[model samples]
Target: MNEKAWENFIVKNQVSKDIPEDIVMSWKRSVRAGIRPDLKKAPQILNHQDIQHIASTNLLHRIFSQLSGEMEKYFNKYDISLSLADEEGRIIASFVEGQLKETLQEIRFYEGGHWNESKSGTNAIGTALAADKAIVIKGAQHFCENWHPFSCAGVPIRHPLNQKIAGILDLTSVNELFPDNALSLTAVFVQSMESLWHAELLQDTEKIRQEFKTYLKNIKEDDVLAVDSSGGIVDKFTKGSNQDIEHLIPLTLRNLKKGENKEEIPLENGTDVKGRIIPVKRNGRMVGGITHIRKERSLGAFRQEQNSDSPFSRLIGQNDNWKQVIESAKRVAARNMPVLVTGESGTGKELIAQAIHEASDRKNHTFLAVNCASLNHELAASELFGYAPGAFTGALKTGKKGWFEAADGGTLFLDEISEMPSSIQAMLLRVLQEKQVIRIGEHTPRSVNVRIIAASNRDLKEWIQAGKFRSDLYFRLNVGRLHLPSLHERKTDIPVLANHILKNIDNQFQIDACAMEVLQNYSWPGNVRELQNAIEYAVLYARDRVIKEHDLPGDLLNNENQRYSMGLHLVSNEKNRQSKETKISEEDQLLKTIEACRFNMTQASKELGISRSTLYRRLKKYELQV
Candidate 1:
């Protein structure tokens, strides 16, 4: 049925009794959630920090990485998009192309956003996860009024061994047409990922068994024991009758600190025992400890003490320039003041923002991040401050909580703050000043307690001069300013970052010294993000599990000859190389914009930040056409 007919059906039947059985059931579920039809926006319940913690450590991410390219190809062909979400219904990753991507972003269908039945109402991913089964929800089947224009199919991916839902694989399209066999295709893909994950888990189990065997050889004492990170004995080697050893030793050797490791105890068997503890450390973390039990001995001295794992530990850099930024960030983390992080594009600004959030007192609370560059002025206002019921066309009938309200007792990291429209900047400044937010179509201002951490790749000062940013807002956000160095300035961290990325892949994926040198030599304009993409690409396509210099992207290497043939000058000088790289970046961005806009000149030109005449001239110069 058309959208108007569906709206009429909803208006005619408040109880939705005439609606399809599945849709009616979903609508009842939403109604029970206290969701009304006039809710304008969905609350951003999950934060980026939670999303990152899941994505970085989950096995599903690795499996999805392998399938993303193929899925992207399929979705692009059908003008649809694919998204992967954890079992909690938080979107972890998404793949979209063309104008459809832009449209999806307008409705907050991006990574880190929650899509559970309660948050997003009836939708494919949310409903599939809620029901623990595959389902298709077309236009008007959705409970949320805002999602009436989109059609989607979803399948829950379960663990192969445990048969428990691991995540959901979903396909969404703006078009209302029913997709041919889309549900079956999604199920097949999810099954393949499950199989791959099962194999990897088996390999990990075998590897752990081998490591345990090696650990047994290192024990020299008969009364010695090996325990896991949780202080449970994994294996024990006992030679003589040490019946008292069980009662003598501590049940769990988890709380002994260095320089304070003395334990003298009298057992119930009338035996006195003293033990020396030697901690087991792997990758600088105390995973377990070794205990030596004695019938009668003096307390042993404790050696060095190590700090517990801190969020700053994940920053992963030793360079002084990089460390300075981290140190500055840590100092202000306790202040609970607004922070502004500035850096070049792909220079790890978002990472720094996350690190700051992790280091702060509000770390235990939600740490939501929203890309200001992705939202226009009106959308940004509603998304950041929320809206009343019936705020605008296609808005949900139930009033919704935005990021600031959702993160009331937490922190909000606004990425690309410089790209935020001037009008929204003024409102944001007011929010910071008054610690309150007024939703759209509402006159009452609600008090909120949210810490602001804003990041920008662009210079806000320049934006202010260009009349695109507010100077007063800049002053408010710049209270804790941090400037992150580009990757080229901190080349020493490249090898470490590369190793970290490679560890996510299988053992077969190897990078040699030659490849490392090539990576270090090239000027990484895109910084760590570009390096990560290169590693991902290499891992995905590497033959025989080895990544060589040949497998690296051509642009990363100094290949001026290729540029010369492409109607661009070949430059050998370092300065010239930098300039040429900028030109190449511009051209690549232009082409990407054109493709994403579906070759629409007007949209492409606007997105490229160039005039139509300039875009046309460049298109002709590159021998391209619409």
Candidate 2:
């Protein structure tokens, strides 16, 4: 053929009508691999044991054994040879007749010969496997000059279970003897093999699933679940009570490796369940897994780990605003009335909630916390009210108990109440009023005895007025309210809080006077959470155990405006002004301060010398940025 013209076409990267697209692409790949058109032969060959190893380890070899006779008889008329190659394109089996078999053997087209595109340039087996499609490489289309005398047709064989290419099926003959429909025939055979293999795999999976179910039945009256690697439940069995098996496990549970195991899994009901994971292996590789749930036992309590001295004591502050809020919380916390704690983000709403739970009569019971903003409307509803079996698509066959049931006789802290969807807000109102929760898809409402502490950074009153929240819900939630002060409103507490935060870190850190001043001066828009973050950042980067002004965030330095000064004087101005006109002017000044500080409640509270929650109330009263 014309090497010069092909090289020119490759150099110009032009497509030619004479060459098929697949062949043209293969030629480009071969050229890029530094292959020469005059190369005498393809490289690489395996010994007998290596070929036997590949055949023994894969299902493709078994399938090939059944196909060999039919393939040999059909290609005998054309004087062609049929070959089967493993995923790596090494010939593991072949069927040939007479002189054509002899011709193929001379060219190392026998068992143990490798034919990958990288080594063999371009041949039917290699290129077909590489592209994962059936194709024919005729005469000069083959890259190696030695292969130019033959026409080869091949198709990739894929395993039906995992959809991975298991091998390649090929038909090769001298150019004159190549059949007209060789490529199509090979593809049809591979498809049939894959279908048959899939049927066998399904049978095996069913048998194994039945074995697992029987094992669970013999061991205990519990559930056995099998999940594929993709987190889809392949099979499940529920014994004794005959209730459907429930998969109340996270998708992350599917990531358990072959040997890695989880001994204890905590359920929403504050009970710990013992389980063992059995990894399913095929050919020494993890394909899926089965989980056998043994039994459920109540633990002391199941709460998220907290970085606090004691629940109430950790709600630290020496200021009057802090003192008043704490006193009010302690009084009503024992009363078992529903409470709503308001504050800016990171201003310790969760801390107060935890403290209330600890100080209340139900201190020893579970304290469950849920972030309303983190979940969607439907999910929030289903999570808080539980879901009956078949409530929605992909729902667990067995029903699930919601947070209300799980936190019975304890406390349920719903954070970010302002972000709760309108539909969920209405449901919550009913739950609070009736003291019962109706699970999705269930007509009956179950009674729940749980104290709720709803928290929000946003003003729910404004949300109600805006038609984004229900006023009735607001009224029900407003009974026992405590608004936490922002760090800016209580600047005097910063030094103490800073020390407490630093002590938690293992390393000793000394704050330079300038850095301390920077911490105090900057308006903490993110409130206490931002302060903790800054301290962590400084502690991480502190050189010689000292935090300097330069070590602080650059935003803190540039944040100095009239508003920053206002934060320092907020308390004094409030104390000095008692007249109605003065109050109106002060309200405008507070508005200006908040706007100047980018409407961050914590920052505005600090400038106004008020609590973050108080600032939220004011924002609601004026309907400004509500």
Candidate 3:
């Protein structure tokens, strides 16, 4: 392709607006083949029949099933009604609308029906397969003139592991109904479907994985063993064992070098359900072993050591705003300035702090946490600054080093600092300014070196104004501010966190894929904490082996937006709450701003806009198209 043609191709691939022509051409020449084109995924041909077809595919079936929920707002986003077809035009899954069910049944778009090029006459699905490339059948561009009323865009969904053509992600929409968005929605859904497919493929590998998971799940507290390719025990979590390592693990990697996937075996205690050994095959050889140590049939909590791409890992969608928040946190963590993390209670301020500390220089030191709100009046003052003998009533006989002293060479995390009494706020400020603190009831000051990480879900600006929190203290903590994206704002992180949790806890401990889907669509009101609790509860209540939808927490299932709908509106989560709290009504809020700008549509729209169409569509797929 020439530069101009390549440029157009590049412009088409990007979900954004026009790009520099030269840059576009450069990208096209760099690579083209095997890259799934976006044109194939548009919703240009969405219809009752389409939804019915999509509802059938295992990929879409699982994807949309997880999306089965109650939420007036999210209903239109998934619409979970799209019909997909294989290259040969064999109808897959679908969510057939009631009104069109009769017509759809008569047409060749229902399950097991065929719509290939030979049958339908050279269209998106058939042509894409024949040409071995994505194609867009624009309004009136259909090879069959009868299809002129609808436009179709389709890209072939390739098998994840083999990278071969699997099926087509085709979006059929009415001509001219934001045709451009159709392209984007198709692509986004296709990507999500692809991600689901990859996860499904991982299930095939689970049989091998189950070997270790089962063995580990039933293993005694100390019992450990490593197994080789044929499921033979190789080693344990540790070397020292009264029992023989020789009898346990097979002699294989003994001659191999250290760090060569060597096993670390835990001592054996009888009652190990059965030690399961899974081989880590590399280049056709069983290079190492992964052994699971299970004490109970129940699933365990996610041990961060294994950060697999599990369903409970994280809730990350295709939203730019939340992505920016994550990016901003990393940048803020790179500096030493005190970071004020603001967000809803469950939005993970502590997780961000932990992430920041792990990325900073003082990482090697102990991370000391002293909740200013958790301490009582007597302990609050002494807990922050070490106390000397007789410093106060019931003080430690000798002097006890406070959090400041304990975190002297490290980070002193102050959670809910706004709750810190006014008396101690003064001392905290002094420490921030002088880098030292005086022990309670002691005249002498103790020299301390610590990076103070303070956080609060409350608005300090308001507290400072109300005289509840000190202004000077607020300024100290505000040096480096990091605002966390609320659950609704970064809804994408929901899936990311969910997957992280599941991979860490579920898949290895128990197979609860269906329950994971339920967790994915849940609106975590308490943010990460609520999600953690729900999963923890489900892990415990799970009977019949794996956690299913019935095993999920009652509160989560009954009320999707329980947290947001209920009161606790913290600073970050309350951005919307604040607007709702202050604004009299939706129309009043919009009209007032528009009228203030002398009814300037563009300016008024800019003042409050992700756009009307955007707010209406929650698919994330639709936003990408826009």
Candidate 4:
């Protein structure tokens, strides 16, 4: 139904047959809650601290960590945004993709926003929580006019142990028509989340058991008990009766907070026992606790070790060739000689240059990168060298400092050096030789001490032979040369590189063996940059933060398949060549027989033991007109 029908129902208090019963009931409840039909957005009830507290909850953290990747996939594929709301309808987290972010943000559909029926109106998150089931609210089915343009499907997620409504999982879209399977998909998602919740509980229990075992090694206590987060007993070791330990369990659970707490409990046998209960935590959330009757010293504070690796450590690779290149770069960083970095496109030439600058004594100064290929031909000279005041038309009145002057006392990275104009190359060579710069329209040369690091993906020797690059300038920059190998040349480093990229994006993310195998087998034409891009793409589409072969980019898989098919084609071509050779030998035999028979078809066919029609067919096959 259209907005007109919705307005009719709101103004006349008449329910339309087109509206579902659940929606009609929600509309009545919304009116009774004193919700305004023109409410612009949901009320935000949580601040930064509140949101942080909600996010720190173990259950919420586990749910988001497990489902966010799949939610991202759905959003990317279907243009849908997913959200999780607490039992009270306060938005806890949201996974949004596509251009609907602005629209959703306009309505305050984000973390800390309250969307209960009383606060906002009839909507998926609110109404589903109210109904305690899965539901779909499409365009104009909402009680608020502001939400009428959106369609949403929501399912309530229940706690695995208690079976109480924990939160609502919602799928929202700005499309004109709601997805027919949106409700069912949401239901399935909730089911998966519920299963994950159960799995998390079991995992937490197992972790608590392990922690207790570690504690058991030190503790000389005769009575000990392990309890989960819910105060349920997991395991117990008792030398005496179990009744005294049972009485201490509740007292231990009562003071179960952070750190260790000692509790004194009086048993029914008129004996008092002293025990210490330590809470076990995972990801900053308490999972379970261990209680034992023992006297122990206070725990020592933990100190984290600082990383002492040099700046070059950022360049991640384990290949022997790559390590050799890095070692050479490190050695070159000690000297102030001109360095030239050469590599194929996307092979991280710029990264090596940056690493050199950061490792040098001039690291504290500015490190400027200029793409010679992107520099305008007309302005190339002016951009590299400072321009005098009123140097030319549209020149800055203040006399702009070029990259060389700007990067003085530091390092200047000239990328795509082969693409630089010949005139600029002459100027660059002069700067390198003279240790100074002469700005355009100025006679007095400026004495600058700037280190140069030039990089190119093309072979400078070829460019010099072609007369495209100046050989003198090449010699000046080639004092300390480092050539980076392509990704294909270092196949063994793919897994480590992929894992490092994944760790930077999300530490919880992991690459499956199949996905890593696909990456290792593929030829990385685009090199490291392409590998990073592929990892990021897989991270976005992966499920449960586990990247699989199917989650990799289509181009990577297609190229791998194409390479395999090309190998098969090569083998088939070899077979065809052998078959053609055999046919040529047979043709030679037929020709000799015909010659021996004096060009008689009947004689040739009879001697060859074949019919005249067969002889004619053989001749046609070999294109022998005679």
For 367-449, candidate 4 gives per-residue lDDT tens digits of 88999999999999999998987899998654667888767778899999999999889999999999889888899999887
Give the Cα error of residue 203 in candidate 2, in Å: 39
What residue runs in model 4 are displaced by over 4 Å at the alpha carbon? 1-308, 566-626
- Say what the RMSD of model 3 is: 34.0
Estimate TM-scores for all models.
0.46, 0.42, 0.41, 0.44
Candidate 2 whole-model C-alpha lDDT, 0 to 1? 0.73
Which candidate number has the best TM-score? 1
Query: Which residue pairs clash in candidate 2?
Result: 567-607
Model 4 residue 80 CA deviation in Å: 62
List the candidates ranked by TM-score, beginning with the highest: 1, 4, 2, 3
Task: Please write out the lDDT profile of model 1 over residues 1-626, one tens digit for every residue.
Answer: 45554566457655434566666677678778877665555556667777655553456875786776567455562477788988888788887766877777777787877788887788898898878889988887787778878889999998775677878998888755447788998888888898897786555444434444444443344365556433445555575358434442354354333412334434456664564454443222344555545433222321111111345665778899998988898898879899988888888877777777767766645678899879966688889999997999966655667889867767888998888877888899999999999999999999988999998888778888999889899899999999999998999999898877786555457887656766765678899889889898878767887777667887865442222233233222232212324455546655565666667776654444333554676778877656
Model 2 agreement with the true structure over 1-626: per-residue lDDT tens digits: 44444555546866567777888888888878887666665554888777644554455676676666456455572387778888888888886757877777666888887788877788999898878888888887787777878899988887675667778989888998788998888787888789877776775576557545534433435566786544557777666342555444342254354254455645566675665565554432244567666544332221111112234666768988888998898887888899989988889999888888877877756688999889866587788889997899877655677989878767899998888888888888898989999999999989888898999888777887889888888888888989988888998889778877876663378887657766776779898899888888888778999987667776765664444435544544332343344344545766666666676766556656544544665668767763
Number of backbone clashes in candidate 3: 80
Better of 1 and 2 by TM-score: 1
Q: Give per-model CA RMSD.
A: 22.3, 23.9, 34.0, 23.3
The true-structure Cα RMSD of candidate 4 reads: 23.3
Per-residue error for 117 in candidate 4, Å, reads 68
Query: What pairs collide in candidate 4?
Result: none
Model 2 shows how many backbone clashes? 1
Give the clashing residue pairs of candidate 1, or none: 37-397, 38-396, 38-397, 38-398, 39-396, 39-397, 39-398, 508-545
